[model samples]
Target: MMGLLLSLLSGLIFGAGLAISGMADPARVQAFLDIFGAWDPTLAFVMGGALIPMAIAWKLRKGMKKPLAAGAFDLPGTRQIDKKLALGALFFGVGWGISGLCPGPALADLAIAPGPAAIFIGAMLGGMALHKITVE
Candidate 1:
């Protein structure tokens, strides 16, 4: 119950941030991805802000043998750059560029513009289904 409550609170906070930052709008994200045209760089700052916490996590996970929450490490130690990762990233970029919606922001938009968000999320789930069928 405690973990569930905390998860719900964190999700709410994240959704609120996405909504307030105008990132929940697909048009805004599409504008950000418009590199050759009238590019909006506002989301770049948001991405930069996110990098700080990501860097901290990277450093800490490198040193820590065990995670604080579960009292055991849940991270991989490999720093290997590989082909599968590159292809996955390319696919993710294509999907994002085409739809202008990432997973979290899509969830936030679901309450407002249901159509695009719903289609994006449904396709995401279908992709997940395909992944599970192939991989595991």
Candidate 2:
């Protein structure tokens, strides 16, 4: 129950941050990606701002025995850059470039613009399902 509550709280905070930072807007995100055209660097500041807390968390994780709401810190155990990693990154980059929205922003946009967000979320879920069926 505690973990569930913590998860919800964390999600809410993340979603709120996305909304507040204007990350939830596809046009703004697309502008940020448009370096060759009408580029926007505002999102860069937002990304940089996020690194502060994450850097602190990474440092703190070095000394942690367990998470506050979980039995263990389920960190990624791999450091190798394999074919799978490269292919996945390529796909992610292509998708982000085309759609101007990734999973986090897409999910956050659900409340602001349900139509487009729903379409993107549905396609994302379908892709995940396809990956599970074929890969795992």
Task: Name the best candidate (by lDDT).
Answer: 2
Task: Pull out the clashing pairs in model 2.
Answer: none
Ten-residue stretch with the least lDDT total in model 2? 92-101
Candidate 2 residue lDDT tens string, 24-113: 899998899999999999989988988999999999998999988999989779999999899999998888888888999998999899
Candidate 1 residue-wise lDDT at 41: 94
The per-residue C-alpha lDDT of model 2 at residue 89 equals: 97
Model 2, residue 65: distance off in Å is: 0.9
lDDT of 2 at 88: 92
- Which stretches in model 1 have alpha-carbon errors above 4 Å? 58-68
Name the 10 consecutive residues with the lowest summed lDDT in model 1: 67-76
lDDT of each: 0.88, 0.91
